[model samples]
Target: MTGKTVGVLGFPFSKGQPKGGTELAPKELRAAGIVDRIQALGNNVIDHGDVDLSGLPADSKVGVAKNSLAVGEANKKLSEDVAKYLKKGEQVLLLGGDHSLGIGSLHGHTQVQPDTVVVWVDAHADLNTPFTSDSKNMHGMPLAYVVKEMAQFLPKTPGLEWCKPSLSTKDIVYIGLRDVDPGERKFIEQLGISCFSMHEVDKFAIKDVVEKALSQVDPSGNRPIHVSFDVDAMDPIHAASTGTKVPGGLTLREAFYIAEEIAATGRLSVLDMVEVNPKLGSPEEKEVTVANTVSVTAKFYGSKRQGDVPPNYVIPRPQA
Candidate 1:
């Protein structure tokens, strides 16, 4: 494992979604020892605390997007923060309020590494633009704002101007998809974006699927990688605490393998795990889901399940 400095940024704002309580994830995950576990892997973990967006100024709603003004303002700040950290060469672990935060995260990541590859792990394809969105929930429309083809359709909102198609369709791939919307499905098909649904995972297996995905996104194996993980990608049995639950999703082991494969590349720059809503499930369900999220995150930072030898070992007892 490469011991790069890790910057943890938490977005506790949940205005992007139509639900409540996802805003509590950052605090809960921190309390569950996310930072300390990364530190155990020998990486320097810096907790940047949470991005508070409760009192931020918002603009008028734009077109069909809900909370467009608030989401834009918050994402603008998040993008700036992400850019600053990446510029300093620190790997970022963004604790998200929802998948909607992806807009800001990708915007900021691309500002530093324009050719960064995005790996989206989710049951739903969040590729709906404001114009195509039926729910008007900004969380489901984040990818639309960051795709090159959809840029012209985006409104010229004040805080959202900084967002552009920092990512091309070829540079982005999706895994664990099962609940894609009709519009998103058409968009993905038309753009020929690489996607591995549960059916593909069962056919090709996770390892092969990941290898193929890497080949498509990082053919030369030199681009920076950003993984956006939505907890809903996991089967509801393993992650019942998330807002949107899909029945047949990735197993816990499969989810960890995905993170492990990305970490093994040693090119991972930013990781955002979102959509974990503690308020939606029972106490046991909440605990299990949170634990699963923490473990997957730890694996991304090289947390060896079997542990490892200390690098700086002085002779505590001299060998004879």
Candidate 2:
């Protein structure tokens, strides 16, 4: 994060899920000053505007990957754009419409770093493939594309036609997962990917958990790390405006602590504040959506209280 130019890129396609709340996330968050907040961190911040999806559904009709072709197109363009920023030695903060944006961002970062690590924070594994996904939402399948696990099912596109693995399975560390899909769970287990489910978070602690995630993502001397943060990863109490709010998510303090600690590492290259929905819960919930998103983004950018103490996160070793 040191000497990195911060750029804001928006991905406003959210047909990936049944809910349509995420399309408004960027606009709402902008009005709440997410851009201004980034500039205050003393970094060269620039907003690259949003991708023009041309109102295509998350999937397309021209590919075997059903509904996922258009998703690939948008993501490929996003990857190209974000890759340019990364190549310029900039820290790109992607404003996501849903977790689906991870596809493009991951592609972009991997194209530049080639060996970057991804720390996916969410309430679900999001590793489902076209064959495995019962819901067919492209959002839940981004990790599948990022990891290059299933190539045969992917659509054929110029830059995205082939599956070049982004982050390795072992390199990925999923934190704050709870309501994972069944097939997705088997995929994660088969891959032996590191994960700290909500049960683990409750048993151990957030501090230790964050430490473990950070270590796994960057064991080789703090290489470039991308954090794809989905607001639903936080406990529903902390963020109830998400389209897919799961119970028992990371608390606001714990979520911010992740950002703060990751920023402290200085190896953190890309920061994504995703899944901030403005159309959920009571009136109070929408109001808090941007605030929580802003808080975590601030923490990621080296903003913190002088005497604030990190949380006591107990990260117990996995059972062999």
lDDT of each: 0.88, 0.77
TM-score of the candidate numbered 1?
0.94
Residues 189-223 of candidate 2: C-alpha lDDT, one tens digit per residue: 88788899888888879888988777766676558
The sequence of per-residue lDDT tens digits that candidate 1 reaches over residues 1-320 is: 74689999999977788789899999899999999888877888899898767677664555468777788889988999999989988999999888889999999999999989999999989998766777878889888889897676666645566676778888899999999888899899988999999999999999999999999888999999999999999999999998889999999989989998898999999999899887889999999999999999998999765765455656588778
RMSD of 1: 2.3
Q: What is the lDDT of residue 246 in candidate 1?
A: 90
Alpha carbon lDDT of residue 64, candidate 1?
A: 61
lDDT of 1 at 212: 94
After superposing candidate 1 on the true structure, give the runs of residues whose Cα lies further than 4 Å from its correct spot.
Answer: 58-63, 153-159, 306-320
Candidate 2 differs from the real structure by a C-alpha RMSD in angstroms, to one decimal, of: 8.6
RMSD of each: 2.3, 8.6
Compute the lDDT of residue 235 as modeled in candidate 1.
Answer: 97
